[model samples]
Target: MNGVVPHIVQYQGSKRNLAPQILQYMPRKFNRLIEPFAGMAAITIAVAKQNRAKKYIVNDLNEPLIRILNEAIETPDLLIDSYSKVWNEQFLYPEGSVAHFYKVREDFNKGNKCAANMLYLLARCVKGSVRYSSNGMFNQSPDKRRNGTSPKNVASNVSRISSFLKGHVEFMSKDYREVLQIAKPGDIIYMDPPYQGVCTKRDSRYFSGIVFSEFVEAIEKLNQKGIDYIISYDGSCGEKQYGTDLPEHLGLQKILLKAGFSSQSILLGKKELTYEALYISRNLQDSIHFQNTQLSIFDSL
Candidate 1:
């Protein structure tokens, strides 16, 4: 392992906290690492710290987010400078930080499309959410915290991510299906798509529409092609058992991950324990054995 995982932008539904546990389930050896629904690319970033794969490919339907990630990897100095300017100014008037956040968000919506602006919005926006309006404009409000993330921390993270991504990373702004189509036999694809029962209609506007049946069909295709994959989706949040039901005949193994209390739940005045299910493909299952009781996958239920 590479000691510590590099930090990336904040994202709603990000698997940042669960990444270490998720990594334990991955195959020890793989030709490439691919993420189809790369929100914040949390898994990829965490995996890259260990230099797990020879090559890395990540894709997201959100173009602006992808652009920022690409910029972070390819041009760290510039991204750092841009973010520093915004953070320095905003941190001064913590009480009036909302005005500064809106200005940066406005620039991002007007097609300025830079990593600094995107980072600013992600750090300042409520719940680290990348929500959009029907007209396709950034609409998330300020978080109202003391201030956004510090410039020094952002710069350090940017530098670390850039160093980690040096020559083996490929960022794509495309539909998940398009990226999934490129996966071959020796590759391991980790998917963290939007939660089915959790993400409401308004929240769904942040990315492209996900037709549940079509998504299952895509997984079926990956299975037929002998691709190894680990999929993370909703299991239970608080008292609610939320998630999509998979076809029993698919033969996928289920791993119930205890994800602790969710930040979203806390925001809503509820202290709900979040449980995520990791549905692992058969091909990759034999190679990994979980010694820790907490990380074991159940054979039934």
Candidate 2:
């Protein structure tokens, strides 16, 4: 491990905290690392710190988000400058901050595509949730919390993320199935698709509907081709289960990791612990060995 963990942009349903544990099951060496549904790319950025792959590909159905990531990778300095200017000039007015935020959102909706605008919205929006209206406009309201990350912090974060993505990473805006189809035998694909039964309304604005049956079929194809893969999805959040159940016949090895209360749970006034499911392909199961099975917290399914 390089011991350098880059800070990822704030995003909803981010697996930032679980990234280290997720990395444990990855192949020691691979020709490429592929992430479909790369929300803020928390896992991808974390894995890049380890430099385990010769190349990396991050794809998301959210076109604007992917554009921002590509811009960060290619011209971080410019993005930093633009974001800094907006922060210093617009965010200074505490009273007008909310109105200014909406103005920026309106501009963004009017086809002014830029990383700075997207970053600002993500930072200031409610709980880092990205949602759009039926008319294809950014619809999430401004977070009442302090004006988003400061210029210095955002610039530093962009620089760090850019440095990590300097040469090996390629960002793409495509369907998860299309991106996964390119994975060869030596490549490892990490999938964090929108959870079934969750985000039904929010997901429709960004991409086509995700049918769980079709998603499972894609992974089965990868299994047939001998490609290694891992997936993150809903398990149990406290007493309530938020994700759809996996089919028993898929034969996936399930490992559960403790997670914090989700944003939705917090809103519902529920303060219970959550768990994330890590479904591993059978072929890659032996790659990760649990030496102290008795002491480990992971549960096998």
Candidate 3:
């Protein structure tokens, strides 16, 4: 909690800041941690840093993102070298960082979704958020705040990420349900699915959308199987709420966590902290609360 865990890259909607609070509800150990919407594998990275899970499954609908995470975790030196080469080339263009950023974005969209090129686009994109056009192209503009992350900094973090998750992770680029279907008793899943309504939009941040009814059905199935899971689906900032709460009959215990401030609030001319909804499976929630109570009692003794 004193310092941040090393993430492979900065991503929009990443739960990096909220990870500490989320971790509080997690058991001290689990056989596996599965993330079906693992953008940059944020929670998995955080959990790995704490050595909470023995095995990990990181899956996403975005192929390039999964590729980047795979490259970062499996071969840090190679990833570092490729990323450095790509980042340095931005300065080589006379038109400067903005021009170079667009060029990288172009290559990424042109089926050159190699980890390095795709990663550069994400690092340089506006607000570090991912946007795609209807036909599945990288559509975000450059964030002229400067060049993307420095190669030196990226290299350091990549190395640390590799060390954190090298042997324990299995990366997948597939429909999330496939990953969820394979889950067994010893697995605890952490999901951060794209927001409901916006996912279907062509230019929305998520590459793909799951129908609301479909998603709820999937959750119900997981519940029926007694799977331990936590979801970060809906949240609020200031007076604006993002999405509807999960249905109560699902038997989840909902907890609100003060995540980082919402950047959208800044656009609305108000600075407000965002509170994310964490819906935990009832069994896991009860177990966590009981363990916490016993710990408090022990501390007071």
The candidate that wins on lDDT is 3
Compared with the true structure, model 3 gives a TM-score of: 0.92
Question: Candidate 2, residues 106-169: lDDT per residue as tens digits?
Answer: 8899998677888888888887888877666788999977788787877777777777777888
Report the C-alpha lDDT of model 1 over 257-279, residue by residue, as the tens digit: 88787888899998777678888
The deviation in Å at residue 21 for candidate 2 is 1.1
The alpha-carbon lDDT assigned to residue 88 of candidate 2 equals 68
Distance (Å) between predicted and true CA of 116, model 2? Answer: 1.1
Q: lDDT of model 2 at residue 201?
A: 48
lDDT of 3 by residue, 81-142 (tens): 99999999988989888988888888777878999998888888887899888888888998
Q: How do all models score by TM-score?
A: 0.89, 0.89, 0.92
Whole-model lDDT values for every prediction: 0.79, 0.77, 0.83
Runs off by more than 4 Å, candidate 2 = 1-4, 92-95, 198-208, 261-271, 289-301
lDDT against true structure, model 1: 0.79
